[model samples]
Target: MSKREMKIKPVIDRTFTDCMEQLQEGYVCAVAATAGCTVEALRRDLFGGDLLITRDGKTAHDQEVSLLLQLKNTTTVRPDPDKETFSYQLKKREYFDRLAAPRKHPKLLLVVMTTSPNQTEWTKGTHDSLEVQYCCYWRSLEGEQAADGVQKPTVRIPTRNVFDAVALTDILDRLDRGEELT
Candidate 1:
């Protein structure tokens, strides 16, 4: 067969979901670094969570404040009619139960949503700046009950709970003050 007659196929090892997860994790790491926090990745798929975020500087009387994060990337998150919240389905009830359970370190679900369905458009870089066309929202399922016998449960996250640098700082501050996140 001539070169023009042969079709070339590209092999892709990572799925879109995987790429989105890594991108979101990197974004979180950048924000954490800017806020003087440290982010450590847990064993992949072994624990119920992905990253552990801890405040960097610890005072004499201040206890260490850390947050366990379950990171999710989705393109099918549905916005409510009122636009106050968005609903995302948790694929595993076991994972949901783990996040809902009370623990020494508070747990949060961080869902990263892509603004565009196209993976290529998810990020753009220039000499001056890098733009990521994604937004992350956080929800604390602590002390909540998972539906009985439901393998996949849908959870609603408030629109106001954006996972930005300000939100992270606020969350860490609250935890350091011995305050629970709503």
Candidate 2:
């Protein structure tokens, strides 16, 4: 076929938000797998949560600990000069309320911030490795009150709460020990 006639149309168009969400979800899934846990995607986005994590092979009523995660992605989060924390504004009041409320399952807001603004640089792959250019932080809003009449509520996430395999394992261990995740 002639080069001019070989142009192919894009099959599906995904917005930047969609791509970011997918990337963050993939990262969480990988981390959970490595930590010997299982992640379930909530198709309906119930309770403003995107995913649920359950400890593997621990079904005892006392030992069973399931975590609910609300995943968010952005390229705009800039940490404070001290690098102690960063803030993210949640757009939905419902989400804020749900996350802040006490529930049977602990819920956390997991925000994935991209290091670069360029979407093309978000991921890189080679035979030896695959790298995702983003870092995630987790915050628990339980017992916190949302500002009344505010459509969007901003929450601060600690830099120390990096969402990684170690962090996941620690969170699970804490939950299994009947300790609060806060």
Candidate 3:
């Protein structure tokens, strides 16, 4: 066989290596705030989402997996782009029902992901508590350079293009195990 024919192709692990990296960093930041230390003090690798956390800890108390909610532009079940501005409200309602609690009392993070104009429009609603934690298409999907180049804002989904349910489940499982995501 020719050298070209013998060459093996590398496969992409759509199992969420990229998104996990982003989430790990975000978790570190959140943990740092809780620890009363600069984010840099935390080791980068500590955010690997590998630490096993007990399900019964005070921090894990009343934590619901669905609180880490995600809404994306899916193939058939996507949120209505025309009604994108109201997407956050809808997600909040779903979250409330899923966790059987009010939106303000969530024990876990509330994450929302959307494409450009939708993210922009939703962000304009400054009064919305849900929009405050928004991650835009540009930051998460398009890979834009932020004003602060070192710390680019990230989107919180399993993958760049498609939302992988298996990978999401694994990540959540790790979180439920008390793994330090950051």
Q: Which parts of model 1 are misplaced by more than 4 Å?
A: 1-14, 44-46, 58-61, 78-82, 106-108
| By lDDT: ranked, best first | 2, 1, 3
Question: Model 3 — which ten-residue stretch has the worst lDDT?
Answer: 136-145
Model 1 Cα lDDT, one tens digit per residue, 100-176 = 87876555655445444456767799999898777788888888887688899888888888788898999998887
Location of the lowest summed lDDT over 10 successive residues in candidate 2: 4-13
| TM-score (C-alpha, index-matched) for candidate 2 | 0.84
What are the lDDT figures for the candidates, one per model?
Answer: 0.74, 0.76, 0.31
The local distance difference test score of model 2 is: 0.76
Q: What lDDT is reached at residue 132 by model 2?
A: 84
User: Could you give candidate 3's per-residue lDDT for residues 1-182 as a string of tens digits?
Assistant: 65632332213335333443354445434433443323332233222112222222236455544213222221112344344232222222332233222233112332334322222232243454323233322012212222343232322333232223333444446555655332
lDDT of 2 by residue, 51-113 (tens): 989876455445556788988776667565478877889878887888888876554655545
In terms of TM-score, which candidate is strongest? 2
TM-score of each candidate structure, all chains considered together? 0.83, 0.84, 0.22
Q: Candidate 2: where is the Cα deviation over 4 Å?
A: 1-14, 58-63, 80-82, 106-109
